[model samples]
Target: MKNMSLVIGLIAGMLFGGGLAYSGMADPARVRGFLDIFGHWDPTLAFVMFGALLPMAGAWQIQKLMKRPFADVQFSLPDTKKIDRKLVIGAILFGAGWGISGLCPGPGFAGIALNPAPALTFVAALLLGMVAHKFST
Candidate 1:
C-alpha cells in the first residue's frame, strides 16, 4: 500500500512537472513578464491560474464531502481562521522571493529537468530556508 502511494505520488509529480513545462510556467522570464504590470505584461499566467483554480475549487468542495482521501489516509486540513503575525511575515517573504526570482517552490522543482543549474540553486536555498524555519520554530 505504501509503495502504491509512492507510485501514485511519483506519477502525479511527473504530470505536474510536465504540465508546468508545457504551459511555459517553468520559464522564469515568462513568470516575470506576468508579474510585470508596468512593463511588457503578459496575462497568460492569469488564465493558467484560473484554469487551475476551477478544478481546485471543485476538488475542495468534493473533499468536504469525503470522509477520507482516496488513499484512505486522514485528511490533513487547516483549522486556523486568524490572520496573525507569522502568516503576514511569511506572505511578505514569499512575495518578495517570488518577485525577485520568479520561481516559487513548484516552478523551481519543475524547472530542474529543463534548466538545472539555477533551479538547483533555488531548490537548495528553499530547502535551507525550510530547515532554518524548522529549527527556529
Candidate 2:
C-alpha cells in the first residue's frame, strides 16, 4: 500500500509537471508576465486556469454522490474561510518575490530537475529557508 501510495504520488507529480510543461506554466517567467499589472499582462494563464477549473468544478459536483471520500481520508471543509491579516501579509511577500524573480516553489523544484542555472540557486535558498523555519518555529 505504501508503495502504491508512492507510485500514485509519483504519477501525479509527473502528470502535473507534464501538463504544466505543455501549457507553458512550469516557467515562472510566464507566470510573472501574467501577473504584471502595469506592464504587458498576458491573459493566457487566466484562460488556462479557467479551462482547468471548469472540469474540476464538474468533478466536484460528481464527488457529492460518492459513498466514501477519496482514499477514505477525512476531508474537513473549511467554514467561513475569510482572508485575514496573515493572508494579506503572505500575499505581499509572495507578490513581491514573484514580481522580482518570476519563480515559485513548483517551478523552482521542476527547474532543478531540468538543470536550469538560476532555479538551482532559488531552490537552494528555498530549502535553506524551509530548514531555518523548522528550527525557528
Tell me the alpha-carbon RMSD of every candidate. 1.2, 2.7
TM-scores vs. true structure, each candidate: 0.93, 0.77
Give a tens-digit lDDT track for model 2, residues 7-54: 767898888778777887767778888988689887788877898898
Q: Top model by TM-score, which number? A: 1
Whole-model Cα lDDT of every candidate shown, in order: 0.90, 0.76
For model 1, state the Cα shift of residue 86 in Å.
0.7
Clashing pairs in 1: none
Look at candidate 1 and tell me the lDDT of residue 134: 98
Q: In candidate 2, how many clashes are counted?
A: 0
Which parts of model 1 are misplaced by more than 4 Å?
Answer: none
How far off is residue 18 in model 1, in Å?
A: 1.4
Angstrom error of the Cα, residue 60, model 1: value is 1.3
Q: How many residue pairs clash in each candidate?
A: 0, 0
Candidate 2 similarity to native, TM-score = 0.77
